[model samples]
Target chain A: MTEELIIAGFGGQGVLSMGKILAYSGIMQDQEVSWMPSYGPEMRGGTANVTVIVSDERVSSPVLNEFDSAIILNQQSMDKFEEQVKPGGVLLYDPNGIINPPTRKDINIYTIEGSKLSREMGNTKTFNMIVFGAYLKIKPVVKLENVVLGLKKSLNERYHHLIPLNEDAIKMGQENVVSILEL
Target chain B: MAEVKLMKGNEAFAEAAIRVGADAYFGYPITPQSEVIEYLMTAQPHLTTGMVVLQAESEVAAINMVYGAAGAGKKVLTSSSSPGISLKLEGISYMAGAELPAVILNVVRGGPGLGTIQPSQADYFQAVKGGGHGDYKMLVLAPSSVQEMADFVEDAFDAAFKYRNPVMILSDGVIGQMMEKVIFKEQKDRWTEKELIEINGSWATTGKTPDRERNVITSLDLDSHKMELHNHKLQAKYKQMEEEEVRYEEFMCDDADYIMVAYGSSARIAQKTLNKARAKGIKVGLLRPITLFPYPTKVIHKYTERGVKGFLSVEMSAGQMVEDVRLAVNGKAKVEHFGRNGGIIPSPTEVLDALENQIIK
Candidate 1:
């Protein structure tokens, strides 16, 4: 099985790290993974996006025009990537600052209050983990135990103490996601 | 089992230098590749392995430092992006003339002059042809994945020493920045002073021995006749590399009607195009050249002789490597070029479209 995903947001919104964590999880499950990011000056403050591929076989293209899923965090990313999702694929977003929601009719659409929920959880840094957990809820490509292992691998040793908090944030995302449309 | 981890191509290349027991690294920071030096600095190979990592004031200084270390028989390397690499071309030519064994990495960015910092394969001609000057050629290795980024370091060093010629790992920003799972080879021990004397002592300026004449290293021979002979010797060495070290991968080409030739990240995109074409019942294949200098001309000629309808050369430049492809085909089949420039990566669908319009039509 191969899952091609695009996670997009403003710079510093953890879009790249979200993709990184998912890629690490894929590796922990003995899967092949590739993470390609939109790098350079635009990533300093403007929109940022990452294309991640997790596959049972070797990945073919690290740069792609379509995705199996798109997890959008802000309005700019949603506007840019809403139509890039493949037909019958999933579109997940955080409905915090989105002015226009996805209006597609051929795919599944889910929303989670990632920004609000992250604020409530008192740690905005776990925002990406929460959204990641929501993705796993809809598509359980990897195991939760493996995600913890992946977290350990991706995070520096000094940040290992916060794994439990991130785990809780992920569980909250899984529980709080609202499926608005499923076709 | 070896160690496996997710790593960026630049970082993987740096870590492999240490693991391969390279003696020194001298480089100037450049976008899309600064992580190479940053990783080495943070890893502190100097403390652990007695390896040296220094940040030079400029690209010119870094390449010259590489020349100095290599002339003394040290396993040395330096890395830079397109612009910085341009600054080092003179030094690179000097090393090629001097028959120095060192590795230079060009994590290429879009070119001409201080172009964008995004990935581009426009350096194909600069790398495989004579980038600096004269009839000199650096053995060029193009790696498509992060794994190959780490894996090719040893092979590069091996070929460098075996030929006593400088080798170039011609990567681009895409491979340098992307992260993927990599399995590293076991750590190798650095050569001792005695080993260096034993292995490279004959020609390398290890030190003048009392029992023998003092060794002299120089690339300058003002006599035209002597320089002509030296040029002939360099051409012979390059020919030997072409015969023995030509490396490439052929995919799904046994019954293919059309073939696509690409290298580095362009090859990865072409693989997706191959899959898409097969899904549509088109017999398409891909030939990925791992060694850009050797050019893989014979394998491409083989495919051309097999009556393939057309050849598509996909790249990230307007058209550079396509010239090499056309020469290889030698007018035996239809040859076409497809690409995007100025830091844009061509999509697989667009490449397939180019194939249909330019070749199949």
Candidate 2:
């Protein structure tokens, strides 16, 4: 199976890092993966997105127009990518800054209050992990254990102490994700 | 050491250079390829393998540095984006004329002059057709994946030294910035002083021994007849490389009626388009050229002889490689070009549509 995803948010919101973690997790599962980011001037405090692909077979193109999933963190991303999700695909978004939520009817739309929950927990940086957790809970493309291992690999040795906090955030995300559609 | 790690293509290229026992690297900072010099500077290969990594003031200085180190028979390299590479052309021509061995990488960006920082194959003509002034050629290697990005550094160094000429890794921003799994080869020992003398003593400026005359490294020939002889020698070397080193990969082409010719990232996208076309019952195939300089001309001619109905050259340029494809096919088959320039990468659907509209029709 192949899962092509786009994760977009502000530059400091860890959107690119989340995609990196997902790509690493796919590698941990011995699957083929590619993580491509929108680089250069577009990444400076602007809406940054990364295309992540995980497949059992070789991934053909790192660039894509349609996605199996789009994890959007801001309204600008939602406005931009909502229509690009394929029919029956998943559209997961954090509803904190988004004024106009996804209006697509063909895809499965879900909301995770990642920023709000992370703020409540007094660690706003855990927002991306929470969104990622919700994504795994909804799709379950990769196992949760591999994501933890992926985190260990992605984070530097000094940051290993914070893995549990990120794991807790992910678990919180899994529990609080609200499904808005059946299709 | 057989360690597989997830690495960005630019970083992996730097690590591979260190692991391959490269003697020196001189480069200027440029987007999409800056990580190569950054990683090298941070890793400090000089501390372990005695490799020198210097951030040159400009691309011009960097290429000249490469020329200097390579004149001493050392494995040296420099990398930059399109505009930076343009500045290095004069030095590149000098290196080619002097027959110095060096590896240069152009992690290409969209360009006429200072174009977008996004990926582009627009540098194909500049890379394969000799961007620098004079009748010269550099062995160009196009890598589609991160693994090839790492692997080609060693291959390029080997070929550069083998031919005593410059070699280029013509990658783009997509391949350079993308992250994927890469397996680094076991560390190779740098050439010892004894090995350098034994291997390159004949032509290298390794200090004069009492037994032989001093060696000079130069590209200048004041006499026109002497310059013609030098040109003939370079052309002969290029001919030998063409006969021996043409490398390409064919995907499902045995029974294909239509062939899509692309290299690097364009090739990767074409693979997906080929799948889509096949699903629609179109007999499409992909021919990816691994070596752009020794461009698989014979294989293209073979397809023409096999009665392939048409050929499509998919690239990120206006129509560079298409010219070469048309030249290779020689009007035997209908050859066309499909592209998205200025860093706009063509989507798979667009490529498929181009195939249907331009070739299949």
Query: Top model by DockQ, which number?
Result: 1
What lDDT tens digits, residue by residue, belong to model 2 across residues A1-183? 999999998988999999999998998899999999999676864889999999999999999999999999887888889999999999999888889877778999899999899999899999999999999999888888999999999999899999999899989999999999967
Angstrom error of the Cα, residue B73, model 1: value is 0.6
Candidate 1 backbone clash number: 0
Query: Candidate 1: which stretches are off by over 4 Å?
Result: none
Residue B240, model 1, lDDT: 99
DockQ of 1: 0.90
TM-score of the second chain, cand. 2:
0.99
Tell me which residue pairs clash in candidate 2: B1-B186
lDDT, candidate 1, at B303: 90
lDDT of model 2 at position B49? 96
Candidate 2 segments exceeding 4 Å error: none
Clashes of each: 0, 1
> In candidate 1, what are the lDDT values of residues B237-264, reduced to their tens digit?
9999999999999999999999999999
Q: Place model 2 in a CAPRI quality band.
A: high
Quality of model 1 by C-alpha lDDT: 0.93
